[model samples]
Target: MPKRDWITRLSTKFRQCQQSPFWHGAVALLLFYLPQTAGADLIAEGRAIVAEHCTRCHVVPEINPKGGIESTPSFKGMKHLADWRRRFEVFFTLPPHPALVTVVGISEERDKSRPAFVQEIKLSVDDLDRILAYVDTVKN
Candidate 1:
């Protein structure tokens, strides 16, 4: 069958299932459509933010970092989620970066060696929380 037809058939089946009052049907629907992790939404949003904002300067995340920020740490080899979680928690406790002193401005100190002078993207406390959760999921 064509892709559209297949989708239509599936939708019809889903509607029929929704009309059923069976506990098993409800359970099956819940499992089929609901996010497995409560944190899944935050993880996805975090991943997108990292990709869009950081990929040009930072290495696309991987198990190895052949060449990326030579001075700064890369997420490549960071295998310990617990450690990352702790580190991120520490980061939150500290004041935001000096460059970020003015809402989300960059430091005047430009380092060509690093991803220099990139303005801090303003993130809500909740956004930071979600980003950390996502990073924990992806780290090594």
Candidate 2:
């Protein structure tokens, strides 16, 4: 608890850390850098997926100018909604969407009631996460 005791303890711990085979400095660097790197990767992958799949029906900024379908909303516009993330999470599981993409045992059942242009596209949960990550970067 004394000043001298605290200093001695700190120095001893530093020495132990330096002597160990484990590189604490490298671990610290990784801890600091990996998340941002992973996030950037996710955003990039998400952007690619959106460009490939959603651009057909939705307006994607920096990728597409006009919405593929007049009725469907633009990705840039959706980013402004308060519940965007939740809406996106379930967007593919809802009514008109049940006709699109089969996932996790969910089968694609094309809705004859909907337009013929609504095509089924398979997407995994990981894909959804990546898409959301990219969507998060969109400005309001």
Q: Give per-model TM-scores.
A: 0.52, 0.72
Whole-model lDDT per candidate: 0.57, 0.81
Where is the poorest 10-residue window by lDDT in model 2?
A: 101-110
Best by lDDT: 2
lDDT by residue for model 1 over 1-140, one digit each (tens)?
Answer: 46798899999999988777896778888887686555688788877765655444445464224645665456554444447667654453334343332222222443456542456555455666676766777646
Deviation from native of the Cα of residue 75 in model 1, angstroms: 1.2
lDDT of 1: 0.57
